[model samples]
Target: MAEPTMRALLRRRDLGLRLVSEEDALPADALDRPLRWVHSSDLADPTPFLSEDLALLTTGTQFDGLDGADGYTGYVQRLSGRGVLGLGFGTEVHRSGIPDELVSACAASGMPLFEVPYRTPFIAVARAHSEAIAAEAYARRSWALDTQRALALAALRPRGLDATLAELGRRLGVWAGMFDATGALQSSHPQEAIAPEVLALLGDRVIDVLTRGLEAGQSLAIGAHPFMLFTVGRGGQLRGVIALAIDALDPEARTVVTSVIAMAGLALEQSEQLARSRRRLHTQLLSSLQTDDPALARRVLGSIPPAPVVVAVAADAPVGPLSDWWERLRAEGGAASFVAESPEGVVMCVSADDEGLLDQAAERFGIRIGISEPESYSAFSRAHSQALAALRQESSGAYRYADTVGASILSALATDEARLVAESRLAPLRDHDTSTGADLERSLRTWLEHDARAEPAAAALGVHRHTLRSRIAQAGALLAMDLSTFPARAEAWTLLQTARD
Candidate 1:
């Protein structure tokens, strides 16, 4: 399916073309240059009307009455400068043979010179090249059809997406990679074909396009490596991107790529639908487990996570990506795990021994997770409540129920409403201290910390007991509360504990 070249034309027995210039005079790849077309002109300057990569056939009429080699040299220079592949001389029609000066000029300029005998018309050469072009085009079309059929059959395999991508890479003789909606590398043909740095660059470009939510293709080169990236699925709902390591594709090759893109998009859409149904089933199974009936859930899932399992709840997590992660784990025969969408966010039940999976998920997705204590399926509801309580704690990354045990009551009361009430209740003491330039609020908190005692509180504050007592009394007066009463002291302690710094 390659274009015809000068060497190919010279091999045509019917054309009877002969290379007049010495082989050494031509550039190494001169004869191998692809000939786009064959044109004949008798004008003194045909450079303006000619294009690159084509042969210009003409009789030696322009050389008539020419004296020196200057005219011939300029003529050859013009044709070469215009990117004309070669010059063909039609002998006998003008002066029985190519002029010696013209041949010398062509040799000096490295212009490929060939002879067109009187018996062979210029039309014959053009027609032969045109026929070759048509034959090449037809062959390409046929190859495209056959490759499309092969890709379709590949899509019907067990691992349709992977199989189709592999087939595409094989057919195109290049590397192919598939990224998921989260911009994670899902699959790649010839898995390690791309270097890590190149892959990182590709990932960044893919993320940029995905963030824009566009259905488009981009051609880029990282150093000497070239890549063609295309977004799969529709705009604003893109499933992923497919990257091919190639500089450019012909029209027929583009048709093949387009077909693969459509197939990949369809496959990913169907995967999304199947994931939704699977999540629904997981949610129902989780609900069944909450009812203290593990048997029904176990029957459906073959087996649940072992008795000592911890339930994790993550708010605003990407359920699709997490589900895909769990699916991969299952495929690898890792510990049994279940993921589902809940009112809180995404919920997962995994073995306590495999809690590291939760850490991995959190790190991979940049999400915070709350994990409960290890408990049996019989207490699944309680475990879920514990995880929810842990989720409410002021923490980042993975917050566990165990980490909350014996923690500060302030952590539990760390909410907007509680902070507002605390600020309001302690405002009088704060304002009074600020106005008087006294440390009454500090003394009061110190006294509370000392179990409402005076001597130790004074020692802790580096002040006399009488001084501490006096500050406490002043604080009580400003707050309009009796400092000696249990209710007043308890209320002050609670307010101080709940207020933020």
Candidate 2:
């Protein structure tokens, strides 16, 4: 509720207050100055005892001995300097009317001066203002209650979060906006109400608050506009922030904003829950596709990314922001894509034509992504494997399967299946060495490393050339490979590298 203004007091008929000072002499907004209370003091110097924003009601007693304009001018100046809103003189009490010297002094000083008829006591004028203040307070409380009800109803709309925010902005007569966890604007009421520079400043403040990972509110001003920002979720798990373009809020208006914040938090929490459920469903669908059954996935999910899609795997990515991004994409009727959480990390499959989407996600989330070559849905599992391999080679940004093809053959063979095969192929020699203490596997590996040269291979093994040759022949017998041939030597060298990797 607004404090009672002097103009409101003059409008009260029962008070019988009349402005005696020339209206032209007063400041244009003099009558509209808010009055804290009305005070009556006849002391020659009432400035020491009076507070600001109040009317000093006098009965002319202070002017009884005043004989010069200097005294009157000093008195009016003191009152004005003390921040008194105006002066009210009780007429027909100590004098027949207001002293001419006092009226001239008030007009010269640009102080509002009024006459209170003796019939209407100073107490009556004070009571009128008190009642006005009370009535305004009551009206504001009623408005607050009604606005809260309207906001609650708005929360029941189809798009409850957006509706609630719009209603809040309308009710408070200010712009309202919501920023996502990523510090990006998610929704705003009266869109485009904020200038670009101010919006950028707001975004910076929002990010600062979010980075603190706390549940708190901030009050700040950008240029001429003031804003109040509040985090919309629990501490350490903030979902987003709500910003109101308001300088200050009365208690009632603050209560209304609190209600809207609660509603928005609940809506966002519900959205997070729904996103999690949808992600789980997507994970299941992706699992079906991984089993080489795109039809089953299609039957459950209605559709999947078209054939000849690139599978991408991302590591150390924040799930909330990415999930929110995906939800926005679906809302905008963008291309269908499959995304899911995996033991490796987050996996996504998009049409090869939409490969830029992966780059966008990578840039937005600061995550490293590895993408596979284009392949049909029937080869989903293979593409997935290729994506995993690409991910192993990725240091940052998006690494594609095609890029890995030119990498070292040793790196290419560094897979779980390759390691298993390599280990199995050399296991017989390992078993023979373990049983008889014959270092056959070591001899064969050393011989392959030295290009099958008997002297250097034996010297490196710290054994005689004849003994090294015998160990290699024994290893060859156990592995069923001819040790002297280039094919056998190359295969042995490849297996050693694969096993080491």
Candidate 3:
């Protein structure tokens, strides 16, 4: 935090800082250290974009040679009023020794003015300031590395998702929530509802950092608040996202977050690969059983024994920290994956093969999980569907196939029957019929997506406004629901979601 003094600045100047009036008000201690870009605009008011930290290097050129009857006094007054740190008045070009009126105006306004003798170029000052700031930043980074190591070694309970997120939030001194690429909460600290603003900010960053097929990590500052980000990768494709926030965190805290994010990313990628392999095996085993040949099914099962698996999916994700929570979930269970997404909430694909895996994950605070019924290797697809259905119902209890009649029986209590019914009833609105159009449902969605702006939606869809109006009218008539209504909108949304599924 050693700031550059006026003496240091003067030394950096090629002609050396000469004492003209010998009445320099700013002490050597008060000169700009890390000055933001130098400004010498001749505009009467350059305050449109210049911030407070700017070192305004004007040459009295804006006065138009005192074109106004008030002399250059008014011009000086305006610059000082704009919160400029100091003024550099060019002396040689317009020499009559800077108008006494201008000097008096600056002094009275409490603005520091420096005489820029004709010999000195403003570029020199800009270059010197840049170097000073760069050096200071480098020192901070070096200190940051050491602090990071110390933070990593801090003792904490060996728990799962909740513990991980809580630890990070505590260390960073900020409320932290982990999101999957689709922006679902993987794990959160000070876990309250997240604001749309926060989500939007992180979401934009995630898209920027991750490639369609690649997953990686990055960091950014939003409104001056620092955040660390990571990518979820699997099967040679990016899976989800992770983000952590640290506002005014210490150097040590920042380093610790960086390390945690990196470690988390590695863990998530590994678990995802494991999940994919298990899923592939499960599919192959089940396919053999479905082939109507018992012996072939046996051979398939013998080739790849059915084992348990776990699932996790991308929720409302952005370029926030993804790796941390995924890793924690893995430690709690045998494996994890970005399962799938739906409006109800994020679903995780967990390989709960062994006994007591759910309890183990819960004990570690791994993730909020609802397990499905278990079956042998020959029913991978069926097992996966049951698990997903159970999750969709948002059941609090762990469901087992054995708990029901048999593997063929899907646990009726495991799913949200009411929601399913509602969606099913609205199926027509979500589906496409030849009488309507190839993508009638999609067209309806696009129309609604633009906030019901008929003209804009029609233009974007390459349709006439009248056509869009007629389609909406026809959809309303067929569904027997006016989608412009709030309740109707919700129903329509559910319909669209079911169709997408």
Candidate 4:
């Protein structure tokens, strides 16, 4: 806050510069202007080289050959227009004393004029002002460094992001909020001060910021609040944004804000690194579960449950916060519950008792879940298939448990088992064929294929209609199972198809 101003520089007694303008002419407010630099330009037109808020020093040599006071007045007018803090005139070289024309012009134009004594060199004043500016800059930088360290420490605490944002809001004396890559609000301090519209605006602008690579801090207004948007990232790769409702136009304040931005970037990187590590672990666990080696799967899972395990699959839903789902499952299944990604969507492995948690997650995230029957670790592959089948059958907003009986049960059976079941159901015909060299199995398949129509079945079989009917009757008698009911026919048909598949 202690900046180098024109009045402060003039109060230094070492330079021996005298105030030439009247006390009434130079108001206290005029001396309070912040001095950017001390420039010594003897040129008549130094406006091109000069910038605003600078103290300009000269020897009055530019006006020596001019005839009238207009030249001197014109020089003063140009200096005033260029925002010169004040004019320092050396009296020894160009004339005997300060020129009356220049003094009258300074008074008339209301430009502060001071006389630089013959003993003091312009270089000395320039060095003094430069040193003062450097000191103020160093002070601000040191303060900013301390603040950054404090913020980093705060970020290490429990609920760290919230703590860090709270500390930042307190430091900047404004509402501060942090957002994730998805523009989800992660944390905020003085939360009530942030209007809902401001968060919406933040979400809207983050897309533009990311797409256009607007990584720099931008000042924008949202409803009643003037917000400062800082994209948090490194090397032009954005991870998140930090919004502050503070007027950070001051150079020192901006430096502090820059430090905060850097901290936010580091925090985001750390969080993302942790997430990547977790994902890698989850993928490894999923791979182990899918492998044929039960030993390796057991090793990866750390333990095998005495109770049967069920796998629940939730696919093609509007993906919600993964952390919420994970926490929900852990709440029911303890730490042993695993949530991971599947080719279809997200997959969860939990005990049968905790399978219902998948229903809660599906309902909350607007997804449909499929729960597989309880199975051991060795049958995880089968359970996964069952869950996928259940998920495929679900046509509404609720979860569906994989059926363990009837035609739906065929989906969970291995190809070999399906073939065995199909052959066993028609074993009597096969045994009879072995003894008598008959084709009743083929005849039965043909009859079922033609929907029990004797004419079409006989034509497809290249046999007489009476012969096909006699073969079908013989097979039904040999099998000793009812073939008239829909359920019996459907079961036979499903088993046969399972065998073919």
lDDT of 3 by residue, 197-259 (tens): 776776767655654544544667776567666665543455566576653445545556656
User: What local lDDT score does residue 238 receive in model 2, on the 0 to 100 scale?
Assistant: 91
Query: Of the candidates numbered 2 and 4, which has the greater lDDT value?
Result: 2
lDDT of 3 at 324: 34
- Candidate 2 residue spans exceeding 4 A from truth: 1-3, 22-28, 64-74, 99-110, 196-201, 411-501
Evaluated at residue 83, the lDDT of candidate 2 is 95
Best by TM-score: 1
Single out the weakest 10-residue window by summed lDDT for candidate 3: 312-321
Question: On TM-score, who's better, 2 or 3?
Answer: 2
* Cα lDDT over the full model 4: 0.76
| Residue lDDT tens for model 2, 1-501 | 566899888878878899998787789989887788888999999888999889889998878776789999999999999999999999999889988999989998899999999899988888888888888889889999999999989988999889989999999999999998988898898899999889988998898899898686688999999999989888788989999999889888989988888888888889889989988988877788898779987888787778789999999988768877866786788766888999999989888888888989988778989899999988999999989988887379888889989888787777888889999998887878788998787788888888899999999999999998888888888889997889988888888888842
Q: What is the lDDT for 236 in model 2?
A: 80
TM-score of each: 0.85, 0.79, 0.36, 0.53
Name the 10 consecutive residues with the lowest summed lDDT in model 2: 322-331
Cα lDDT tens digits, model 4, 40-60, are: 978999999989999999998
Q: List the candidate numbers ranked by lDDT, top first.
A: 1, 2, 4, 3
What lDDT score belongs to each candidate, Candidate 1 first?
A: 0.89, 0.87, 0.56, 0.76
lDDT of 3 at 68: 43
Q: Please write out the lDDT profile of model 1 over residues 312-428, one tens digit for every residue.
A: 999879898788888878877997888888898899999989988898888878788999999998899989988888888767778899988898866776677988998998898
